[model samples]
Target: MVPVLREAPELSLWLLRSPSPDSAAAARLAVRELDDAEVRRAALFVRPADRVQYLSAHIALRRILAATTGCPPESLRLGREPGPLLSPRTSRPVLRHPPVPVHFSLSHSHGLILIGTAASAVGVDVQRTPTIEAVRVVGPALHPAEWRELLALPEPWRPAAFAQLWTRKEAYLKGLGTGLVRRPAMDYLGLGTDADAPPGPPGWIVRDVLVGPHHAAAAALAVAVEPRITLRTLPVACLYDGDAGLPLSAAPLLALRRRGSWTLRWSLLERDPPG
Candidate 1:
């Protein structure tokens, strides 16, 4: 049976730390769960770390969908045209047909990985806090009104406020699938008067996510109603343990046995900073 979410208008965010033996094991399990094309794409990654990150993110997404759809994890097909979607393979216009009710986005920064899933179209972004000088260099490119407003902020708060604004813009664009191709300058995301509650584009709801003191993250959903997000750290063992009837090979099982218990630290960004 498909498990229903405990909260309405809620999004699920899963975080995974840097690659380790346990993560590697989890990646292998993820590989087993993926379709052949996905496995081929994963194998093409030149860097082992990149491969692990891709696998871990996709694995967590599959687990989430499996729980929601009551489908076997391995049987749930996922594809990336630009954003996450429930499809057999990667292709543009995955949404040209009936829109997939489930939408998701993924972002990774430094060693932290974030995956967000919702019933509506969603996008997420994470960025490391930029140096004050870095912010100054790029600040002018923002919407003129936004830049002017940012300058009025107290000096100490500028960096965080800028980070918040930047991520929100990025998340919104990502949701739109235009990325930087659509001039951000043309859009006004309010960062000047209110850092926590920026004026997002109409029809989209934006929220700043607090990953930690050093990093900033944000999410945008294509719904008027603000989404309540639930964040959790997914351990490698949990992925293997909750295979949802997916077959596992002996090699991955051996790897899991060799690795000791793995733990991840997570911080919830329940609220934005007081404006």
Candidate 2:
């Protein structure tokens, strides 16, 4: 069973891999879990692969959120808060139904989707490591200190190092509710080699997420001190059954338990009896 929602910030991070290309029918069925707006948005994707990814990400997000809130995935109301000058990039995601307050953030890149949940405000970002050429073009836009650190690294090491700093900075920006409106060069989230480098902005905790060698990810929380972060993987096939594209026949039963004062252990069951 999902742990009861709490007042204090307890961070949970879930990583989901997108379904294979041949699972088109199953993808179509999973779209039922999304709202009309999400369905329309998926339709807007010109590439069939893009559409599949968008569907997989949304379905997994709703199912995971539903598990925690005990509400049907389709019943979770999702909307965006208006931003200054009506900029869509600045608009923050808000959930208004079931009256159970929880802060969540979603991010996807390539085949991986990351979702972060917490009692207090939170933000997350994931990125496929960029090529050396791409890194050279965008690396300078990061904080001057970060840029210098990147320059100091060997040529072969720059891509991964740059991705690490980039994800951290983006996570912080999303956490601040400013997105890219706040200049990336303004904050210092460095490669940790510099003894003088500042950790991050005040009143926030930023940490790197281990997504594997091909990708980099990070999460930030709006709290004075860092909280224990729990990481779990959700398999795409578990969202539905076979090629029938039926509704979550084998739901992921995440049994979360507190082993110590701060450790969270997640046991992923093979199948959950229909709730």
Candidate 3:
């Protein structure tokens, strides 16, 4: 079901478990909501699992945007040209469009999809907790200070700590729309006593979100004031049931006959004042 935001939420997050593609009809239904470009991108995936993840994330993104903007799911156009922006405020899908002022980010990992939206530029990322080997390989390349603090953690806790830092940095970069093109090592997010604190950078707020026991997620927003973030899980059944057009009050009833359930998680990080 689509979550109803009382006001423009400082940040709104939606999470959905990816659906299996074994049901040919289900696979087709997922793609039907996507535009031609998205369809082509989904088809480019060599593995069925990869394709399913891509389609599910995109479809979930559209539905979430549709619900908030009071538009049809198929009408919104999702793109990465300027970093995951949506367009054309209309109720029905169209081939042409005009720009709408909205900022969003999307990430998928291990059959889970996450979408974040806000009035200001926003970025979010999700990752499965990393292995020791994986952390060992990438740890040194992180901002020098952050790496040192990570290594200082107890052996068993380092992997998860590293994942948390990585997600924060990635979310910041995604929010900036520079992706990895901007060197992550150039920025210090914090370490040791400051691990939960906002990074050195100005004008951005980052927070760690608890997605599940096995996964880590973080969100970053480019805004002047400290903002509150709300998280909600929309049932995958809501989209397939053709309920995207339903009013917000009817959302709860749409949570029927779902093969999986959604778990909502939230985190709030206020910006650190200047020295």
Best by lDDT: 2
Q: Rank the candidates by TM-score, best first.
A: 2, 3, 1
Model 3 — which ten-residue stretch has the worst lDDT? Answer: 266-275
TM-score of each: 0.70, 0.82, 0.76
Off by over 4 Å in 2: 1-8, 83-86, 241-275
Better of 2 and 3 by lDDT: 2
- lDDT agreement of model 3 with the native: 0.68
Which scores better on lDDT, 1 or 2? 2
C-alpha lDDT of all candidate models, in order: 0.64, 0.74, 0.68
lDDT string for model 3 (155-271, tens) is 899888888888888888888776766677888776546444335668888777766667788888887555667666655554564444333222221111111222331221121
Candidate 2 TM-score, C-alpha based: 0.82
The RMSD of every model to the true structure, in order and in angstroms, is 10.0, 6.1, 10.1
Q: What is the full ranking by lDDT, best candidate first? A: 2, 3, 1
Total clashes for model 3: 0
